[model samples]
Target: MVRWLLVLLMFTGMADAAPPSLYSLLSQGQYQPPMQVMLQLEQNYPGVITQFDIDVQNGELIYEFNMLDPDAKTTVGFAFKASNGSLLEQKVAKLESDDLEELAAVTLMRQKQLKFSQLITLATGELDAYLTEAQLDHDLGISYLELKLLSAAGRHKLAFDIANLRPLPLLKWD
Candidate 1:
């Protein structure tokens, strides 16, 4: 249900006018950059941000952050208004065993002291696409940065090997 709503919004007229870049929005002085919003969220949430997304609904832009709380064994999602970084809503879900494993992957990355914001910027700039979502996942000791992007052609799914900072094959959804 939520997926469908997000897909619908992607095709709506309002989403068509999304800014070309975070800097564009900054130059306009209309909305806070995603990085700043992310920093603020980190200060308040005190967890590892596992995912981030940009969404449009009701003609307003929203920045969504999904955080993993290792101590609490839960995942919390926060939605913030893009214009001013005002938090709109928050939802929490209990973590399962699989989630704990994922948490371990996140913890390993944390120990390495790697920053994902740089990768986000690189991926978006390289593809010349609007990044809609980014998530961290690991399998068989390999950590991947999964990204969803919208470009002139259509939606695209991309994966980057976090260890090497190399992008894998690109998958497009028309």
Candidate 2:
């Protein structure tokens, strides 16, 4: 039993370096068949790179890359019996682009739940008569406010809580 476990610890777990962070991949991608780029990321990252939503920023198209690193033991996790250490369950989130809000807004616009009309209403009080609008409603109820943020022109930006961040898995309970 110990021998089999030993093999797995050394050979598997760490796998590869996760196909270069989505930020690096997308940044290097040319203005070509964008869909193909996304497909490649999805295929390469699988459970990690879950969503690729695009938006326009200052007239240039941008993408918000969403990833979910799965929960798994790494190659170096410590074997309690052996008191040995291994790299287990390595997870660290990353942001690939500076214009995350612009990308997120565009993503939010395509989302079914984020209606432009409601966004307009919400903006009436906080903002002046609208020159443009966007909405992002699919966020977990806790981050629901992020939807409103994406819609406002000149103010669209994504600011997430890094410390409390949780994986937004592609899987759903409902």
Compared with the true structure, what per-residue lDDT tens digits does model 1 show for residues 17-115? 654554344345577877788777767676678899887666567899888878888899899998988989999999877676558657866776665
Report lDDT per candidate.
0.73, 0.33
Best by lDDT: 1
Q: What's the TM-score of each model vs. the native?
A: 0.69, 0.24
* Count of clashing pairs, candidate 2: 7
**Alpha-carbon error at 5 in model 1, in Å?**
27
> Which parts of model 2 have CA positions greater than 4 angstroms off?
1-31, 72-174
TM-score, cand. 1 vs. native: 0.69
Question: Which pairs clash in the backbone of model 2?
Answer: 74-88, 76-86, 76-87, 77-86, 77-87, 78-86, 134-151
Worst 10 residues of 2 by lDDT: 74-83
Q: Please write out the lDDT profile of model 2 over residues 43-118, one tens digit for every residue.
A: 5542333333444433344434444322321111110110111112334444434424433443443353433233
For candidate 2, the per-residue lDDT at 69 reads 28
Checking candidate 1 for backbone clashes, the offending pairs are: none
